[model samples]
Target: MDLKKVERVYTSYAGVYDQIFGKVFHEGRESAIRNLNVQPNERVLEVGVGTGLALPMYPRHCRIVGIDLSEGMLAKAKERSEALRLTHVELQRMDAGAMNFPDDTFDTVVAAYVVTAVPDYRKVVNEMIRVCRPGGRIVMLNHFRNGNKLIAAVEKVISPLTKHLGWRTDLSLSTVLEGTTLHVARKQQVNPLRFWALVECVNAKNGYVVLNGAAASYANGNGAAGYAHGNAGGHYASEHSV
Candidate 1:
């Protein structure tokens, strides 16, 4: 996908984004931050924080740094942050595939509706892992390819058309996580017809040796791991739900 075209599409949508998509993806956004389980004083990073829709949902006890590629989107997010008086929040214009933060910078990293929207999804995932501390949480909310053969076939056919609208529908969850150090602990289908996925992973960089008990449990195949299908409120086994 062309980066310029992608930026242009989202920049143009900045004004009407909340009006059009705010309610449609509200459940998934709320579920992602709620399940984030952020701790007091912990540092958090939000990738592609478009319009800061999830900004108000986050607890103010922790510090949050939000970044996006579109200046228009960031402008709206800044307005939201100011309107809500979220003193702990910071906004920046940056590319998701090449973040400017150093290694192990944040306690949790969230990417909602971001994977398929980028030019190189794997590169962005790696960047997420790079900036996240060991055993930290990497939460992603997006729509992956349908598991059903018939549905997957249809998505592939219309993927080109969808890409023009700023995102592709043919990306699979596995493809996004493959070769990355993200150890997924939970993958749930959430909200709006159960068409989107909320994947919670543990940043197991270096190896499983860096993981804590919760993350290690997943790597050892001893934890309860399953694909959940339902609304955002749907419960699933988790490693970071403290």
Candidate 2:
């Protein structure tokens, strides 16, 4: 993928992106964050932050660093920070595929509506996992290609044109999940059309296993296992919910 072209596409529309995508994907974004259950002192990194639409929603107690390749969008995000008094949120202009952070730097890392737009989705995902500490939550809120044959065919036809607009319409769930250690904690269909996917995965490290649909986290040093289960109201039990 041409990085310059991708940068240009997002930069050109930084001013109008919120109007175009804000409400359309708001439900998924909200659900992802709620499920994340970010704590007061957690360090969170938001890749492909773009215009900082979710900045205002983040907990004020936690520290949030949002990065995007588009300088224009980062500029808007900065303005949003000041305008909305989001003191805890920081915005930067950087490529998500090649972030310059140390290993295990963040407690939780999130990517909203970005996988399909990145030049290399796998690289960005691995980077997100590498920077996140063990037992961290990796959340993604985006529109995946429909599983239905006719709808998928229509999405594929439109993706070529849509990619130029800074996103794709035909990104598949399996395509992104392949070769990743992240496991789905829950999968929900959001939005009025029910086309968007709210996928939450746990960034489980060494000695991880899922039993009976719940993630049971067991590390070498601990005899106590962390069991997480899905709660009907949306949020999962933190650490030992199962």
Candidate 3:
């Protein structure tokens, strides 16, 4: 959340990020993009595209633009784009909280493993929603605070050190959705431990529509296993992947 601190932290991480996070979080990034089911010629926006890890996975037909606040991260992303010949992807260094695009610009907006890193998570969400079309989709792949008291307590103790890593370990899904128009249409557990979540939703004009019993504990497999239930008319309750 601290811009200056994040800049300092990732300034030197661009070169080694792949070695550290590539394999561990690879599934999370792949699953998030796959869930998008992008159609040809669709306009897509990726927020906080650290080192452009997902750029190659994106469909070549789609007009994809990735934005991040960290120039350290964007520099590597640019190189990746060039190396891989990802002509459809564009990298830009910009604050997610204050996006420059107009309303209803992108058909699908995705944020991969970056919700808690921004100075204003809420503002970033709003911007993502604002740029997304009315019937578009907004997907997020992120880690949240564990519901276990012991795990949460430990996270709190080390929360101060998160600034150095450029992300927080105690963020909650509810905290990220404090005042957003999007909702969790589907939630899939990514990563081996299922610590990371792949959330997919539509850009509804109404308020958020999270599935029933959507909570950190629910995702952690302590309470109930993930399941999706439908309501009258149209609504889907939250559930984990198979």
Clashes within 3 Å, all models in order: 0, 0, 3
The deviation in Å at residue 32 for candidate 3 is 0.7
Residue pairs that clash (backbone atoms under 3 angstroms), model 3: 211-238, 226-240, 227-239
Q: Is candidate 2 or 3 superior in lDDT?
A: 2
Candidate 3 per-residue lDDT, tens place, 162-219, comes to 8567888888887777666666667778997998888876665433234443322111
* Colliding pairs, model 1: none
lDDT of 1 by residue, 1-242 (tens): 87788889999999999999999999999988877666667788999999999999988978899999998999999999999999999999999889899988887899999999988998899899999866667889999999999999999999999998999999998888887877666777888799999988767665433322322222112222222222333322334433
* Off by more than 4 A, model 3: 206-242
**Global local distance difference test of model 2:** 0.77
State the lDDT of candidate 2 residue by residue for 70-130, as single tens digits. Answer: 8988999999999999888878888888889998787778898889888788888989988
lDDT of each: 0.81, 0.77, 0.75
lDDT score for residue 85 of model 1: 97
Best by TM-score: 1
TM-score of every prediction relative to native:
0.87, 0.86, 0.83
Give candidate 2 misplaced runs (Cα > 4 Å): 213-242
Error of 1 at 232 (Å): 19
